[model samples]
Target chain A: GAGVSQTPSNKVTEKGKYVELRCDPISGHTALYWYRQSLGQGPEFLIYFQGTGAADDSGLPNDRFFAVRPEGSVSTLKIQRTERGDSAVYLCASSPDRVNEQFFGPGTRLTVL
Target chain B: AQSVTQLDSHVSVSEGTPVLLRCNYSSSYSPSLFWYVQHPNKGLQLLLKYTSAATLVKGINGFEAEFKKSETSFHLTKPSAHMSDAAEYFCVVRLERGGNQFYFGTGTSLTVIP
Candidate 1:
């Protein structure tokens, strides 16, 4: 079975640019989540969606970060005016439902230079 | 507030020896705990999770964790260490404080020696 997957395993962009990272959750999964991992640290939650609507977006650091999942299976994490602090491995995860363990993706490493 | 702490930043164990990784948590609500492992340059994999079920939870790769609400601890353990077990371990706690979110620890790097 296919696991959660993120595209462009690696992305390098300049500061003050805009970027979008995509995630394809496992088929039939209604729960999708996004997280960010910095060097020598664990992943921090970013956003989560159940079905077509976002169930939670509190983890998003600021207004510059936004995500949407209109179809409930594919989600995108968008960053505007990227900063050096935005450089991190963006991880996506999905589960059968809420309150269950989640499976993760290979993640997209974004580097700002 | 909800938070998790990996007491040790790193743990070195000889192959075939016992492995123990300590974790403690604090949450205003009843928290759901999880253990995830990440190999170098790889994505995080679920090792085990402790929800509102049995306190002792067993997971893949012969790993298990016991949740103790009294102490607010969920320590992961394996009877014997394997060379492939070398990786970074993260303790996570989930809560619905206002909205659903997961809090992760700094992570504990496990080094298995032969």
Candidate 2:
């Protein structure tokens, strides 16, 4: 079976530009999560989705960051006016249910030039 | 608040020798603990998890961990180190309450030398 997958493994953009990262969770996985991993540090939670709604967005750094999971499967993380601080590996994970072991994706490395 | 601490930033071991990675955690409630490994340019792979069922939990690749409520520790260990075991390991603690938030440690990089 296919695990969680993310598109555009690498993305490079200007600091002031906007970018969107995509995540495809495992089949039938109702819960999804997003995390950011900086160099030499563990991953930090960003956002989480349960079905079509954003269950928890408290981990998002600021208002410029937003995420959507319209269909309850695919999710998109949108960052407006990207800054150098936003450069990191964006990781996505999915679980069959809440509070269970999650399956992670390879991650999309975003670099702000 | 829930937090996790990995005692060692890096560990080096010779092949065929024992390997140990220490981790300690603090949480208000009964939390779930997990260990994950990440190779360079790869996603995190779950090594094992403790869900309050058993104190000793075994995971893939001959890895195991003992969950100690008294000491608030869940350290990963293996009987023998292999070259393939060299990678970065992360200790995670998840709070079941408040949307089940997850906290990760700084991570420990393991180096297995032959």
Candidate 3:
């Protein structure tokens, strides 16, 4: 029934540019999460949102990374001044609640040149 | 600090052979363990999860994992490997506390040779 989905399957941008990745979680999912996966590596946690407010942002790599989930359904991950190191697949996941297993999106591949 | 460790970075097996993917984890509290598979250009799919329910958990597509608390391991195994089973597998551990953040292990890439 419509799993988690991410927009802009692939994105390319120059260094120092800004980029935004979008995610639409499954219906009725109250927990949303963002993760970054580098080449040949597993996904690393970035942030988590419970409803409209972010419950945890400690996994965000730096200040340049920010995410928001307004109205509790759609989420946007924003990166300011993108860097070559930021080149990776950004994944989004959602769950019915914090204790349940998560459903993941196809992910948005971001490349910073 | 909750963390997961995948014992093998790559595993190759011929079709119809047994398959095993090893994983170990460390967490301060009782954790929820999961196995996920990612096919090329596809999203990560849950193979199974162990939430202190039972030692053995069966998942979709003939996959199963056993959680061993004494050894701190949750290993995935399949009786006979299928060609479609080739993919990247990740072991994850989630702490019950600390916002329930999931910690992922380095993935193990499986190669099924027919």
List RMSD in Å for every model shown: 1.1, 0.8, 0.9
TM-scores of the candidates are: 0.97, 0.98, 0.98
Docking class of 2: high
The per-prediction tally of clashing pairs is 0, 0, 0
- List the lowest-lDDT window of 10 residues for candidate 3 chain A: A1-10
Report the C-alpha lDDT of model 3 over B68-114, residue by residue, as the tens digit.
99999999999999999999999999987757689999999999999
What TM-score does model 1 achieve against the real structure?
0.97
Ranked candidates (lDDT, high to low): 3, 2, 1
Of 1 and 3, the candidate ranking higher by DockQ: 3
The global C-alpha lDDT for each of the candidates, from Candidate 1 onward, is 0.93, 0.95, 0.96
The better-scoring model by lDDT among 1 and 2 is 2
Error of 3 at B22 (Å): 0.2
Candidate 3 residues lying further than 4 Å off, grouped into runs, are none
Residue lDDT tens for model 3, A7-87: 999999999999999999999999999999999999999999999999999999999999999899999999999999999
What lDDT tens digits, residue by residue, belong to model 2 across residues B2-111? 49999999999999999999999998789899999999988999999998899999999999999999999999999999999999999999987767568899999999
Output DockQ, candidate 2.
0.86
Q: Write the per-residue lDDT of candidate 1 for residues B11-46, one digit (tens) a residue.
A: 999999999999999987789999999999888999
Query: For residue A105, what is the lDDT in candidate 3?
Result: 97
